[model samples]
Target chain A: MPVEGYAGDGHFRQTYNDIHILCQETAKRIKTEFNPDLMIAIGGGGFIPARIIRTFLKVSDSPESKPRNIPIQAIGLSLYEALPDTSEEVVGKEVIRTQWLDFSTLGDKNTKYGGLLGKRILVVDEVDDSRATLSYALQELQIDVEKQLKELKVSEEERSRIREATKFGIFVVHNKLKPKAGEISKDVAYFSGTDIEDLWVDYPWEMPDILKHDELKRQDDEMAVKAK
Target chain B: MPVEGYAGDGHFRQTYNDIHILCQETAKRIKTEFNPDLMIAIGGGGFIPARIIRTFLKVSDSPESKPRNIPIQAIGLSLYEALPDTSEEVVGKEVIRTQWLDFSTLGDKNTKYGGLLGKRILVVDEVDDSRATLSYALQELQIDVEKQLKELKVSEEERSRIREATKFGIFVVHNKLKPKAGEISKDVAYFSGTDIEDLWVDYPWEMPDILKHDELKRQDDEMAVKAK
Candidate 1:
């Protein structure tokens, strides 16, 4: 069975501690499983977690090697073509508002991977929902590396580093419930801090919504009394 | 003696560990001084550091109290009216790109502080340079809270809670060197993980430009060889 999504009854409220610990664990997994030198974080979702994971990677680094100085690149990906007005419009839809592989929004306009010729790379995000986002990211990276190799003339050693560099995906939560189209390539591995069911995962970042909902309810009650 | 800018010989590079440590210390400062129930991260700069500090607050909370369940809100602010064409465009001028207080870019559409009547709030970000961004954030937050309190109808206790709630500022790096306009009210304390002499602090998040520079130099060398 493909390790995709999971089903569950109740929602999972991930606390700050939960996320911090998961990032630590994810860093550990990356060290042993991937040992990546570059971490590419998908913006918004992956940005915060990726930073935490990078910090954790320092502690997880081997005693001998200078702590892995894994440089991070942030890329923005949005499935929506336009912002959906209604909840119904967003349900079960993947209307891409922004391109999945936009280079313009790449967090750093500088490096452009000229220094990453032979580095193992890790692409990270908060969740792997339909798996499409991660899939697109992996494919684009492969295409980018291939293009760079063909265009740049470098020593055989540098060329080999570019050719042999590996890429993988990391997520804080991997939803094993929603069935996605395809898996990340066999050669490219994926790691998650935690596996969660398809139910809603309430993150600390979204607490404002919960607070706002309560406020609206109180206002509605007061208005109803006035109407009566 | 206004803290406006720092003159220095070399660039100050801030490593991942430096940031992580600073965030931890900022959390400690917040515990003793502000004890805020909410954290608002100024986007781009404040997002990551704010989140890390928020996490640290959980650990810093007193043993008897439920870990400070402080909620976070993210708002984006850009000083540039237009992006500079070359790196030189941004050196000396404090360009105004976006509105001083862009609430539209606030991460959540739901709350908008409908429930913030009595809650203590903290505005967080990476740096407090020139202090314009932090100054604007403090003023806007004061205005928003005042507006919400006047318009919304809630219990006397809730109203009191809202009125008593205070706002503070937190930063990973507070460059007291670059002077700006008015300060945040003395009642609303500001906390920083560390302070540095006014100098160019190169963050890991901004590593791309450095990498890009190396790439450009290599390309230039190759071109020179061809010309020869």
Candidate 2:
């Protein structure tokens, strides 16, 4: 995530506070709405709120902060995971592991369970950087990844491969970093590219399971095509 | 801001299409990088990309079809103004004279030239019924005002005031809707709340002088604060 520097202005503080409030609201909503079995938070700087919410859950007595049955897992895709550690007491129960996997380190073949395989994983990283890495990683994991890669402006060869792999259920985070002209694709889950503070509520999490199942089917169809 | 139901197993097209690709990219960096800009966008939703960026300038191209400039006039206590008629031809600018006003509307007293003031704006129809109305009207306006309102969670009192107002500036169109949270405070040009999507980039033509001055002043003071 990019940080804007504004001399002595309280912009940073205001921004942080805004993000914190959003985090609290999101936590509250999750508690009220679809109480998922797991919250797989992807991306790096975006992980701050997840960490804060985790801390709040551990300490706050608010009704909204009551103990949760589901685990909130923070996954960092880069070379390192920078979020604070989970409370030892909550480990394995409330909060799960904060694992950092270097996809670059993983060779073509799968190494272990931790290695990307059929596991339903969410890739969260800056769109540009993540696009390249996600495409490559999913391909190596033998999972189909789907994305236009037009924003990344990659070559046709790369685009074709990504399309082929995406047939295996890989998805991308959609939203804009700045305002521009064009229609937003209705195919994928998108959050506002400009707004990072409302990640909890604004980002679409209500994706239907049928879509995932359909994506899997697409992958199967593609594989069958290749076989033919 | 039309919400189209996709039947392709949930996987549709890219949300940011091609025209607003830069906006999406810039927003990502804004949230991640420390780049400087007077205004910023923060939030997530289907319509965020165009709403946030279009508030800055108009782009004329495919997908975005009618692109026009929407300049920023001022940022003050929960209020922002996109100068009237600032948007260009491609985007077909239409002023949505809303029937709602809130505490943010009070700040409209600052609009000296022909701008929003003391307008009988419509507060959202009662929350329950209002959702449908907002959805309908917002769709007509081509902006998801309801989604933005939901994300904003404006207080009833504020909503009543905005609704009772006599005049106001409204922007509407119909492509993608970008709903956001936070407001520019009424007193200073300070932004409160979380997830701001900087809209200054879109309206390159009508950058508010006051905002520039305030920003510079804020920067100087911040320097002093940091030095202390």
Candidate 3:
């Protein structure tokens, strides 16, 4: 069973409160450090956190300022399979595989109207496990921006603005860095809420079956304690 | 060409500020009236409004209150083509053809445990035109709940609770009612931000081309006023 290797002994368990505080702090840090013009959230896991961040970034509460409405972009990217862990395997072994289900361009009108060009962008996700997903997302974003620039018939000034835009990566949790060769590029700045050792982290939003297993285990633990 | 018939003449032109106020007001109304256990937002259009509503309905600001972390669901229902005006005819004719490209079941853990079984649900969208989309969505929700009940082997008490749950529809703009026979059931209550004529409403999130058309028309209107 996948739960057999549960590292519950001293693993850093995070509750919803922990994640929420982290998001608030991360938003503040990003505002001071990066001051990004656009935020791209990796969907599914990143959706809720990204929304919170956008809310904090709102300048005004009024509706007339349509431009002040939260200007975040969402992209769906799924890139992991439950293959056997092979840290000790030979270099030739398949360690991880990726899947890109939907790669639609940014649909937000603000993003289309020269928002992404020549501005700082922050890509947010819940976790940076193995960094494979984030890496692929950043590369794809570069391609998307370049494609948009080619299609847009804009002035030379606008072209320069689009060309000079920078990108950054952010996460709620960052496992202790082992620093694999050429996995994440050095040019992209990275931000994270908390750092931890290499252990399986059980998030609250896991599938129903896994959640049921977790509940059962908790009940069993409580029963054993009472018996003792 | 679609902008030719824009309801700018004596039309209820809404700025971002106006929409924001309406969303807050609508959120308050839903709270006092229905007090829904869950909010299912129609993606793209309903996303921002739903988020605002969820924030207003927050039970607490703490992170530990997992239940209050906006227990909302997203359904991607795209049934429109072209720019704006066709929403009455071509879009209206095909509004019933809802493609659930991402019909993810409600994942809020509380909803899974008991909330959804016998709870009030609010389905939110930006506009209710001809009532086709909202009607189809309500029908689909009924089907989804029934299917869930069938799959889960619950006791008779739980089954009854699930059956007793109700639904409500909400929109930012409700077009003038030209009620068709049995289109929107009388049983289902609906709330709206405002009501306007059957003329096409131009939203701020329009595409660049449509926005440009609006801007050019505004310029021409100003030029005519200056000449007069």
User: What are the chain A TM-scores for all the models, listed individually?
Assistant: 0.69, 0.32, 0.65
Candidate 1, CAPRI quality class derived from DockQ: incorrect
Judged by lDDT against the true structure, how good is candidate 2? 0.28
lDDT of 3 at B22: 64
Report the C-alpha lDDT of model 2 over B4-77, residue by residue, as the tens digit. 22222222122212113334344343333322121111111111232333323332335734532221221101
Give the TM-scores of the predictions, in the order they appear: 0.46, 0.22, 0.46
* Of candidates 3 and 1, the better by lDDT: 1
Q: In DockQ, how does model 2 score against the reference complex?
A: 0.01
State the local distance difference test value for candidate 3. Answer: 0.52
What ranges in model 2 sit over 4 Å off? A1-15, A28-34, A55-66, A79-176, A179-228, B1-228
Cα distance off (Å), candidate 1, residue A216? 20
Q: Candidate 3 chain A — worst ten consecutive residues by lDDT sum?
A: A81-90
Better of 1 and 2 by TM-score: 1
> Chain B in candidate 2 has what TM-score?
0.22
lDDT of 3 by residue, A31-70 (tens): 7777666666555456545654554454443565333423
State the lDDT of candidate 1 residue by residue for A31-81, as single tens digits: 887777667666556667776666555422456535433445555555532
Q: Which stretches of candidate 1 lie over 4 Å from their true place?
A: A1-9, A59-69, A80-116, A154-161, A209-228, B1-45, B49-124, B129-228
Chain B in candidate 1 has what TM-score? 0.68
DockQ for the candidates, in order: 0.04, 0.01, 0.03
| Candidate 1, residue A197: how far the Cα is off, in Å | 1.7
In terms of docking quality, model 3 is incorrect
